[model samples]
Target: MKYSLASGLQPPFTQRESFVRSHPDLYWRNKGIAAYEQNRATDAITAFRRAARYADKPSQAMIAQMLWVGDGVPMDRVMGYVWADLAAERGYPAFIATREKFWHELDRDEQRQAVVVGQAVFDEYGDEVAKKREDKALLLARRQITGSRTGHVGALIVSLRLPNGDFETVDGALYYADKYWKPEQYWEWQDSLFEKLPEGKVEVGPLQMPPKR
Candidate 1:
């Protein structure tokens, strides 16, 4: 593991926003979103393009749509297709459908060019994209999100039900715990396994927002 964090309550979104701003990759993403929502298509495209350099998926998808329709940016169908295809590969399912829809919409040359361009983007940006995910996970771990709680395995304690972007486990995460921790710290029903502490449970569905301050 290249990352770890101390267990503690997460900072509020206001603070989180400040933290994210230091990361150009994530900061430009917010800028693009704000620009797009305000109907500043050109600025949105500009921000998205910069964000794309960090392999930001939403920015890639947004730029793809803008280019495909010539909304804020000039129509560069091939480049649009390239970004769309790249976003699709990164887990945005909608872009895959959009790219397919464009199959007959684009000429043979454009189609071929997009494929080549998309491949190039993939080869170049794959590592950066992966790094972004890792960074995000590390951030979440450091914050110890509000919904998160502690767990135990004998003497080994851990955080349970970590957010999806970080830990995908239903059980819990030992993400920031001591390296030598083990499940045998306490007497266990199963000698080979650890389990959630009886008091621990997580809301896996949409959150019920706290009454506004």
Candidate 2:
């Protein structure tokens, strides 16, 4: 389900801020898309990198595309392959295909370089590290909303705006549905937001490569 604020009801600014903070992967990914569409390649890359830190697969793919063609950053096919491989970790078919394509495009030297750079990338942005970062953010967001470390404070009523304009008033302990509270569920939900790409089509495919200076 698409997690968004109520359409009709305007939530407090702080509440909206808290919501964005809780799901930074989504925020930065969307921000990257906007910047990219506006031709702000540098800003888009920066935003996508931040999103990748939270395990945003699409953002990871986008970063790989930009880095591959030197759109905003220097061309580094090795690092591009590394990011593509990272994006493919969860076995998404599109991402997996893209990763393979990147590998096939590389020479033996670049492949070796990719393996080395991949280790460093994984140490920082792999699911093991990235998921923990997002989990901590979610935990902190829940604490702020429920005002309790355990996400419970007896009879605390938390009203959440549902997609259909209805408000679901739930206990503080249950305020965040599994999709928002549980890291795995949250990742799945976010994954669902990705549109299915055509076979052999990378969603963030490279444009024409810029001429070398």
lDDT of each: 0.52, 0.72
Sliding window of 10 residues with minimal summed lDDT for model 2: 1-10
Error of 2 at 42 (Å): 1.0
Instruction: Report the C-alpha lDDT of model 1 over 1-213, residue by residue, as the tens digit.
Output: 111111124323312443355345557777877787787888887887777676566577677777877875788888877777776553323444555665667899998887777777777555455445435543454344323344232332333333344523222243333221222221121111212223444222211111211
- In model 1, the runs with Cα more than 4 Å from the true position are 1-16, 127-213
Residue 57 of model 2 has an lDDT of 83
Cα deviation at 117, candidate 2, in Å, is: 1.8
Give the number of the best model, judged by lDDT: 2
Q: Which stretches of candidate 2 lie over 4 Å from their true place?
A: 1-18, 152-175, 191-213
